[model samples]
Target: MAWDTEATKQKLLNAAIDEFAERGFAGARIQEIAKKSGCNRERIYFYFDNKIGLFEAALVQQLVTALDDVPVRGTGPEAVADFAGRYFDFSTTRTALARLTVWEGLERGYPVGAEQRALRSTGKVAEIQNALPSATMREAEDLLLTIVTLCNAWVSTPNIHLVLTGAPDLQRRRASIVRTSELLAQDTV
Candidate 1:
């Protein structure tokens, strides 16, 4: 019987995401990831070369999935706001991405797949520019960054939400973020 290399790699990636999200790259253990995936440690080394490689792959996977999932649809300030709302919803459910982002910033101090991630981000920025014709490229990039930062913060920094709001209210925060995005989009236009 042939071994399912893709399935094994996917399982390892899934487990690696969970492990890295919960415990930053520095704290995550290869053994723990292997045990979580029910694969031998050798598979991790073989598939990813090392822990850093696995971490970068995991982060890139999450980012690619996100870009595919919540696309900037329509063409207007409202579209930008809509994208922000959808991205916020995505972040809330897929907390691992947000957590992983936080962990990467804290531990690495630089992005793992910088060139690839930048290319992906450039696409999104172009989408924003398309939606808001009045905005410059730099403005669109800043807006995209602002929307992402806001959405990610709500998920990754629950303590901040609790401290500011006296309690964590996902719905309230989501609404606030959406409205904020809309206002920012209007300004861009």
Candidate 2:
């Protein structure tokens, strides 16, 4: 029988994402990942080279999904605001990316896939610029950063939200983020 390499790799990556998000890089164990994936430990080494490699791949995969899933449509500050709301919605549903980001910042102290991630970020910044033509490149970049940071923070730091709001009102928070994005876009343009 032929082995399903992609399927196996996806399983491992999914398991790795969950483990790393919950435990961070230092606390995550190969054995736990293997068990969660239901794959032999050898496959992790064969496909990813090591734990660090798997971590990077998992994070990169999530980043790719984030970029591809939420797109900026139309042209104007409204478009930017729409994009921010959609991205926030996406983050709320698939929070592994947010948790993994926090874990990476806390444990690694540096981005894992810096160059490739930067390239993707540049593309997103360009999209923002396209939506708001008058906005400078720096303004667009800062806007994208602000939108992502706000979305990720809401998901990754639920305790903060609870402390401030007295309840987890995701809809309220989402509305605020969308409005803030719109206001920032308007100011930039």
lDDT of each: 0.92, 0.94
Candidate 2 lDDT, 1-189, residue by residue in tens? 999999999999999999998899999999999999999999999999999999999999999899888989989999999999999999999999999999999989999998888998899999999999999999999999999999999989899987888989988999999999999999987
The count of backbone overlaps in candidate 2 is 0
Q: Which stretches of candidate 1 lie over 4 Å from their true place?
A: none
Candidate 2 overall Cα lDDT vs. reference?
A: 0.94
RMSD of each: 0.9, 0.8
lDDT of 1 by residue, 11-90 (tens): 99999999999988999999999999999999999999999999999999999888878889998888998999999999
Model 1 superposed RMSD (Cα) = 0.9
**Model 1 poorest 10 in a row by lDDT:** 161-170
Q: In candidate 2, what residue range of length 10 has the lowest lDDT sum? A: 161-170
Off by over 4 Å in 2: none
